[model samples]
Target chain A: MVIDLDRCTGCEACVVACHSENNIGMSTPEEAARGRVNHWIRIDRYYEGQFPDIKVKYRPVLCQHCDEAPCEPVCPVNATYHNPEGLNVQVYNRCVGTFYCANNCPYTVRSFNWFDPKWPEPMQLQHNPDVSIRPGGVMEKCTFCIQRIKRVEDQADAAGRPVADGEVQPACVQSCPAEAMIFGDLNDPDSKVSRLAGDGRATKLMEELGTKPKVVYLEKAR
Target chain B: MKHLFLLLLSVALVVPCLRADQPILFPHSTHINKVHLKCIDCHISADTRDAATIPGVRKCMLCHAKIAADKPEIKKLAAIAASGREIPWQRVYGFEKAAAVKFRHGPHARHKVACATCHGDMPNAITAQPLVKHNMGTCISCHRQNNASDDCATCHY
Candidate 1:
């Protein structure tokens, strides 16, 4: 996943999209006060200079899906681990809710389910059936929408062909009105995400941490 | 020794009675053996789609309309078809939502995996029952044998 900060308008379509697509539990006022809101992807706002000469910057942050993820080793139950496809998969069933992985995360993207997810009357019908409604006592973050990836992969495999570049779009990437995010196979040199990764302005968040995050953030070209 | 034998005999007799009857006893044996119908004949999407969907009342009425029209079960099915409401067939085999197992029938069917492999002996039975227990172990063992992916994300998102 490559996010172009230059294109981001801070509209937060990705945040809304993620909530709807992932069946993330809605946070009550009491939960929100305790800082227990669930957001798989969140836009971080930074204001430079004083009010008169202010400039706002929005950085959409999610699970970096680090190759050498700090969260993986800390998991006692092996609930969180890097899959063969290079995704940091958090198996909900296996999770014992130790919160060790959540503590070790540099990005602070992982959110714990404080209570069971509840959807009001009609809202229940809107849930995406592909993604599991994660129960309480499990830590969940962005999966890079693994369900979407698997669905495309399955369809491609059925047709006896490889998954095409730009075929697998995470909810955030698909819903971005500015087309700020790009998701594809980073291993494929010709892929758009790979191309963006090699761009002069592209930089990984907290690269010095040695996490080797797959997401590349393109600096706002001033 | 005599009391133990009596207790065992009562349990054996009562267990069969405990099994709930289906809304309509649509016999798979009669359809498969007598009419020579394949699994896919009724379950049209078995090879092409994720769900091996149970055919609606219309599909049942297609054959039951002319053959055994006098039968009580057929008359009930015909009434359902006439009312344009789907027969509420109870699912025999399925994973719980929490399991998050996205079991697609298309791939298995296309791979030439016999229907009896997961769904045990449907052709010989009167009504469908969960004869084979479908758990993670069962899926993993088969995948390992076929050199298929045992990756957690492959089925569970």
Candidate 2:
């Protein structure tokens, strides 16, 4: 999904939805103070200019699911791999916690849980039944809702039909009230995501790194 | 031998206890059996991509205002609704952290997998406890048998 950074209000619905959907735990004030929080999708807030004319921007950073994912080749155990659906899938149980993928990620989108994540009793009840919980010591990242994708495909198959475009959307895209996140098959030129990816302002993070990220950020011309 | 057979049959019938430790002891049988309410009624969000989650107090009050206005639990629920505080529902069944699995409720529910499959006999449950132990092995085994993707990435991030 390409997020228009310019249009994002930083309302954080996507962040909250991501947390609820993916079970990403919040870091304690102590841990957050030290810059260690488990956020699969984070809004990168940047400050530009100074004093009176100061400006701010919010960019959501996540596992880019790069076509040439740097995290994939470096994993000794093959814990991290690219799925056919263009997802940089990470296998938590298979991850040996070598931190190789974390180091290799140019976007720095991966987060390590320093401690057993806690939701404080009933808060844990709010955990989404769909997503798995990552324990400490394993590396984890986004899968672009492979479970949902598979579910959609299964449903289509049960009905003896092909999976339709826009039939599946990740939580972030579904919850974005601004409709800022557009998710679709990039292979189809008619797909919303494919057309958006070709926008003049579209660019990948650290493109020089040559990761060929499926995620494209549409920059607003100032 | 006849006595032993009867004992084993009873154990098999009762071994899977109805009361597990769910966050909320949702009385599905009472709501479903007595009141004749549909599962989707209280869980209004189910039709969407998300699960049909526990309805908030307002939804409860929507009918309880007339249905069970005098009931103690309903009255208390009304008070909570008036206070604007959200219901603190505990999850009965879920994946633990470290698994890094994503399980969507809507898709499964839509697939005709009875709520009882994972939740286990919700119509009889008093408290939500672990009816099914979900591990990687169990999940993958079912997927493999059902011709589902057993790819580790299929469940994990």
Candidate 3:
């Protein structure tokens, strides 16, 4: 996935879309106030310069699907593992809720379900059938929409062809109103994600940490 | 001492056989053998969908309405259908909700696994029974045997 920081307006359509598509529960008033709101994808806002010359930057952060994910090794139950497709996938059932994954994560992308997800009447109807509604006390992070990936792979396999570039799009990528996000097969040189990764402006979060997150961020082009 | 041991052994054998019978008398002996109805005839979505769904009352009525319509069980089914209700069929085989395992019958059926593979031999079953304990190890071993992916994400989302 490639995110162009220059294009983001901080409108947060991607955040709303992620919650809706993934069946993430709305935080209660109490939980929200406690800074315990559950969000798989979030914008990290930072203000640059002093009051007279200040600019706000919004960088969307989620599970990097890191090549050397700190969360994966810390998991005692092996609930979260790096898939062959390079996704850092989490199995909610296997997760024992140690929260060790969340703790070890440099990006702090993993979130724990505090209670059984509650949807107000009609809200339940909006939940996606493909993504399993996570149970309480399970640590869940962004899967980069593994269900969508699998569906595309299944279709490609049935047709005896390789998955096409831009075939799989995570909910957040498709929902970005600014068209700031891009998702594709990073392995393919001609793919948009691969191209963006090689851009001069492209960099990753906390590069010194060497987590090697698949998500590449393009800094604001001033 | 010998008499007590013999009686205890007989009771243990009898108890399991009695308990193994399902609540409903959906005998394969009658449905598959004498009647010769296929599994998919009742399990409508077995070949197509994620779930091998059970037949609704109407499916049962297709044959039961004319054949042995006077039987008490058939009458009950007819009444339920007339009242616009689905049969409260308890799950005979399933993973627990917390296990979060997604088992699609369509893929397994496409792989040419007979219903008896994981479910055990049901050709002579008197009623539905959860004969096989579907755990991760069991699934992984079978996938290994078939050279299928044993990826954690394959079954668990």
By TM-score, the best candidate is 1
Q: Estimate, for each residue in B1-157, the C-alpha lDDT of model 3 and write its tens digit.
A: 9999999999985564345344345566578888888888888888656778888888888988899889876787788889898877667777677777777777788678888888775666656766677777888999999999988899787
- CAPRI level of candidate 1: medium
Error of 3 at A140 (Å): 1.3
Q: To one decimal, what is the Cα RMSD in angstroms of model 2 from the true structure?
A: 7.6
**Model 2 lDDT per residue over B1-157, tens place:** 9999999999986655544343333556788778887767877756445555777777777787788678766676677778898767777556655555666565566666666666666666444456677776776776777776666666565
Give per-model CA RMSD.
2.9, 7.6, 3.5
DockQ of 1: 0.57
Model 3 docking grade = medium
**TM-score of each predicted structure versus truth:** 0.93, 0.64, 0.86
lDDT of 1 by residue, B11-84 (tens): 98556434447778778878899889999998889987888888888778877789899998888888888899
Worst 10 residues of 2 chain A by lDDT: A113-122
Score candidate 1 by lDDT: 0.89
Question: Over 4 Å off in model 2, which ranges?
Answer: B1-150
Give the Cα error of residue A176 in candidate 3, in Å: 3.0
What is the Cα-based lDDT of residue A160 in candidate 2? 75
Which residue pairs does candidate 1 place in steric collision?
none
TM-score of chain B of 3: 0.83
TM-score of model 1 relative to the true fold?
0.93
